[model samples]
Structure formats: C-alpha cells, structure tokens
Target: MFIKIPLHISGLWYPIITNNPLTTGSIGAGINIALYLTAKLRNTEKCGILLNNEEVLKDHSRAICGKLGVNLSVDEKSPISLGYGFGLSAACLLGLSLSSLLVKNITIEKATWPAHVAEVIYNTGYGDVIAEFYGGLEIRVKPGPPGIGVVEHIYPGRKVDLIVSVLPGREDTPSMLKRIGKETYDLARKLIDELLEKPSVEEFFVKAHVFTSKIFSYDNIDKLLSPYRSKIIGYFRKKQALVLWVENEWLDEIYSYLNKYFLSFKTWIDMYGVRFENTS
Candidate 1:
C-alpha cells in the first residue's frame, strides 16, 4: 500500500549549529520531523524519522532490532518511508548524516536507502516551509523554526538567485563537518549578528550569498565533488540558470539534455517553471 507521510517544520540547520543557542532568527538550513505511519509493517507498529533520506535506514534498523533482540524482516509488507530534501546541498548532507548516526545507536537500519541522502536541510526555519509551499525563492531570517521562540518571519519578496554545482561523487558530510570546526560556525554567527544589527534584507542577501559561496568554495569541497562540476558550471552560462523566470518554456529542452548527460546518476525531479493542477 502507498502512504503519504506529512512532516512538520520543527528545527533548521542554523539553529542546530549555532554558537549562541538563544539566537533563533532565520534558518538558512531546513530541518523537519518526518512522522511516519508504520501500519503496513507486520512486525514494527510505528516509526518516525528526523532524516533526509534512507541511506542509513538499514544500519539504523539493524541496530534497533539487535538491541531489542528481535528480528524484523523487510518484507513486501514493510512500511514505506519517504522524504524529500531540496536546496543547500551542504546542510542536507549534514542533517542526513547526523540522523544516520542517531539511528545507528538503535541497532536498526533503513530497510532501503535512497541513492542520494542529504546530511541536513540547510535553511532559515523562517521561510523553508513557506518556500516549499509557494515553490519559489525566499529571503528570510536565520534559525527560522516555527513557534519556537522570538524568531519572526519576514517575506521580502526578493528573488535570491542560486547557482548550484552538482558534482558526480558524493562528499563526506561527517568529515567535512569535523574539518569546519567551531571557528567556521562562529565566523558565520558573527556575520549573521552583524546583519541583524541593521536588518537590511537586500544586504542580507549579499552577505548570505557570500557566506554560501565561501562554504561551497572550500578547497576540499571543489576537489571532492568534481564529477558534476563541469555540468553545474555549464548551467551558469545558460540564461536559465542565472535568471529567475518560472515558466515551463524550457522544461522539455533542459530535461532532454539532462536525461542524456547525467543518465547514470542524475535526473530532474521538479522543474521550477512547471505548473501542476490540483486534481484531488
């Protein structure tokens, strides 16, 4: 049986790795609790996840079963879990990796893991959900979780253009996190604090972009994920990659090429310009 799991936006990357936990602002990273209904499974009754993908599911499931000394098989009737993490590849990488570690403690693993698993969802909790709802670019505060603290939501209606470089090989999020250390996070916090002093949304965009670029340009990063570098860079030269136009005019053209080039590993999921009618 097919099941649709609903998620509630709870925490975000920025807050989760902040120097001062008190500062709940905008979340540049996205995080959520995936509440799963496991009635389909004959053995396990229910399970929920705070993960971005199923890569660590098998290991996690194994840990849980081992600890409890009960063998739970992944039969055809097993419960299905699905999650989607879009935007900020780095944050997604971190969150997903951390969750995997948490699952490993339980001696349980994912019955099945997806091809690509994000480590974390990096977004300011403020606009992650709103952006997901509207399916557009958003400019909001850091540490942006809903109803957590004094963190407020402000939609500037400004277009934040992105240039993403999708490389072939996967970067190790755990290793990268270790290398970044507290100093890196502190620098980001300081920059964010400065931005908060006056609070200019436009200025914030420029600063945020700079911060993002710095993270992306880390020496280890460029070298680790070089396979898709050329392709991601190539997109920048294309008018569509740089500009913000939400029209399906170029949908077929783009996918046709993607299906041909990244046939082995990559495929387009949801094109920004496409419109879906509500039939339900």
Candidate 2:
C-alpha cells in the first residue's frame, strides 16, 4: 500500500500573562488530522511517505514505530534539501516508514498509489494559534498533536509589552528544547506561578509580536545575519515586541525575510490574531 498524506499545520502556544502555570496550550484548526492518520496507516520499508511538514512525518513515524518493534535509518540524501518546519525530524520520519513497511507486508517496488485524496492544506500555528484564541502570552502546553487545554491566569494586574523582531534566520525548536532542557521550562513555569500569585486589579492588552526564526544555534544565526544583523535588531527594537526567532515562516513580510536570508522566520497570520493583509 502506498501512503501519501497531507500534512496539517496546527496552531501554536503563545505566552499570556496568566496566573495558571500551564501558560501553554494549542487550538486546533479542525482540518486534516484524520487524513494524516490514514496515510500513516499504509506504511512499509519500501513504501514510505511524501509529506510537506516534517513534524507530521515525525509524529507518524513515532506512532508507527511504537506499534512495531523496529528501527529504520533515515535517508539524508535528498536531491535538494529544504527546511522542513519548526521542531521536525526527518530521521524519525524515515524510521517510521521503514517500520511501516515491515508490518504491512508490502515492498516499495510494488506499491501503487494515486494522487493524495485529502490534499487539503490548512494553515495553522502553535504559539500564534494559542494567543489568537486565548489571547495574551502563552507557552505551547503540548507538542505532538494540536489540542487545547484549560489554562487559568491567577494574576490579573501586571502587564508586559513585547517588542518582537524578525531576525533573518531560523532557530530549531527541538534543538532549543534539548539545549534549554528543563531549565527553560522550569523558568517559564516559575514565571507563570509568579503571575498567578500577584493578580492585577485591571486588564491590559499588550501589543506584541513574537517573531520566530529558523536559525537554530546562536552561532549559525550570527553567520546568516552577518550582513544586516544590526538592521534587523533595529527593526524589532523600533517595533518593541519581544523577539522570538523560530525555524519556520508563519506570516508575511516576516516570511520574505526568511527567503531573503535563505532561512525560515516565524510570523503570525490568522493563527496569532494577525489579520492577513491583502497584497493583491
């Protein structure tokens, strides 16, 4: 069986000033989870997947790998390699495909598959999706699937303004998570706890844009932005929103920056409550 799946982009987990410690959560775009699952079901060592989103492929691989006791190697040889997305693993995807083949009793040479049936590309975000729906700054509660969870902000008075800058590079979330480890998450949790203890008497809406950059390591980012590093920082400093460079393009001129720098930059579309500007 030939499995061709359409990857869905889920919303993101943006931080909001809330009393709840779980200042992270995601909202679903309600489009293509089912399709991803179906395509994943038909897997074999020879019959793998052709997907756009790396995260989706990773998820599919993990699920299938756990089902069958097998380990597969990833094919790093690509005719032309392109950045997958935020926190995606190509090796994991290859592992899943190989395992799927073993379990399905099929080979890659004999698989006959047509055009993907549910070829629907739904736009989604993790941080932006959470903020747009829940409002305020929020952390991504869950990483795997796009699902919303309950979060309560105990503190109501303290307000923060984020001056986000779009750096011309990509930052890998998975690598960051590994590097930051529990320290970053622990700090985030502590901050959330601090907010909860001190409730604000009034509600305030902070104008902020959390910029994502595909630049993973600081050294790599420095190399990419060696030309206009100051200019990019100046742009965000002027905007005055907290800058969070992520490894993917989620929005507009922000995305252009990614292409310009030959890197991925994260921006907000409808996901983070940013209105889509009509360019046509």
Candidate 3:
C-alpha cells in the first residue's frame, strides 16, 4: 500500500520555549508552501525515509510505529530540505502516522499524536505538526500537543506567490532554540497578535519580514537580494535559508533575476493540509 502527504512552511512567528513549567513553547503560524511526502509500505517490518532519493534517519517514523504497534517497511520522499524550517521532518512523521491511521482504521487524533510527540521529543519542531494538520495560513494561538494546541487561519482570498531560496546547508533547530531568549518570543507574540487583528496576505508578509529581521541577523543572502528590494513585498531569513513573498504578477521577473544566485523555486500557498492517495 502507498500514501502521500503534503508539507508546510514554518514562517515568521514567535518561539514559545522556556524553563517555566506553566508555559509551553510553540511556533506561530506562517504560510504552508508546496512540498510533499509519499509513503510506500512493503511487507517487511521496518520503516525509513528518503530525501529526493537518498536514504536518511528513520527515528521519527520508528517512534510513530512503536506507538501504534504496527511495523511495515516504509519509504518516504520529499523535495524540501530537512532542517530548513520547511517542516519536512514533521511532514514525514505525520505522513507515516496518517497512513497508519487509514490503513489500520485508527482515529486521526490518535494517529497524529505520536507524530506530534516525536517532534517535541526530538526537538525537531514545536508547532509544525499542528499547523500542517490544519493547513493554509495558520496561527497557533496556544501550544501543547496536537490535541492540546489551538490554531486559527485565513484563506488567501486571492492567489499569492512565494519564492523559497535554499542556501547550501541546514540549520540545527535544537541548537538554534538554545540561543533564543524570552525577549525573542515576546516580540514574536506581539507581532503575531497585531497581525491577527487584521489578517491579509500583504500584512502577513510585512509582519513576517519584520519578525525575521528583528530576530535574525542579516546575511550575505540579504545583501544579494537587496537590489530587488523594492519589487519584492518582503524577504525573511528562514532557518539557514530565505523566503521571499512576491506579487503574482512579478514572479517571472523575480525568478529570472534571482535564479542564478541560489537554488530557488516558486510555489503557492497550500490550503489543504496533508492529503492521502493509495497506490496499490
């Protein structure tokens, strides 16, 4: 049996991590970009993942299987890089869990729990699983496990274009989390709240760019794209990569101008969360 699941982009938002027992650290909503995970199940009793075509760690998938008490050979594929704030790892784990739900007749809430737990346990992500589960432009109002977390989102009333530029390496999210302080989280919360008051795609880009700039330092990529600053709505540094929001009409010109600088692609917002397809 086979199943495929889509992925989401972790965008500009606050990080809610702390030593305080009363508060839980969670990510705010960003955009859901176009990425995917397709899982193929075989007769063997093992699970694994492949990025593009190369094999990678299966710990997250294994964790889900252990919780569900089901073991089968699994192959997962994705186009997005693993540690670039694209939520590819969360997507893979969730995809496997969702597939298990359909194949084993388990409830979605139950199936997704392990995926969410795996992410939290491994420090892979805080809210990507929950946001990906809901899809579209999501805002996580409260944080916890999937059932415990609360999310709200707006549908893009019109078509919007996104250009994601991936740098040569990956960002260690766990390591990055250690450097983030409460002040960062406070700023993110403040901006997100302001954004929620009047939600629009333009406002989202503006707020995201502001949040990214406030939290992260300017890098060479920022300098490289400075020439086209006026044409692009806003650009934000994501993990070790960068994502630019552009008006739909300007996509072609921006793509042409920036394609030579880095590995880039143009995608739209994914309103639907994870999807499933069976190919037996």
Q: Give lDDT per model, in order.
A: 0.30, 0.28, 0.71
Question: Candidate 3, residues 1-280: lDDT per residue as tens digits?
Answer: 4555556665555656555311353757677776566676543456655556666547876777788788755567766667877777777777667767645876776677777777877888888877887778888888755566788887678777878877666668888777767787687888788878987778777777776766567667667777777778766776765778887778987887777876788887788776666464
Best by lDDT: 3
User: What's the ranking of the predictions by lDDT, best on top?
Assistant: 3, 1, 2
What does candidate 1's lDDT look like per residue over 1-280, in tens digits? 2122222221122434444322333344221112222211223432222233333344434443443344433222112222222222212221222233222453112211110111122221223332222222222353322223223333334432222223233344334334445665566566656655645434443454445444444344435335444333222111011111112444444444444533211222121211222325
Per-residue lDDT tens digits for candidate 2, residues 35-142, read 112123332333334433333443343443443444332332221122233211322242234334544565431111000000101111223222222223333344
Q: Give the CA lDDT, 0 to 100, for residue 95 in model 3.
A: 63
Per TM-score, what order, best first? 3, 1, 2
Query: In model 1, what lDDT does residue 39 have?
Result: 18
In model 3, the runs with Cα more than 4 Å from the true position are 15-27
The candidate with the higher lDDT, 2 or 3, is: 3
- TM-score preference between candidates 2 and 3, better one: 3
- Roughly what TM-score does model 3 have, to 2 decimal places? 0.88
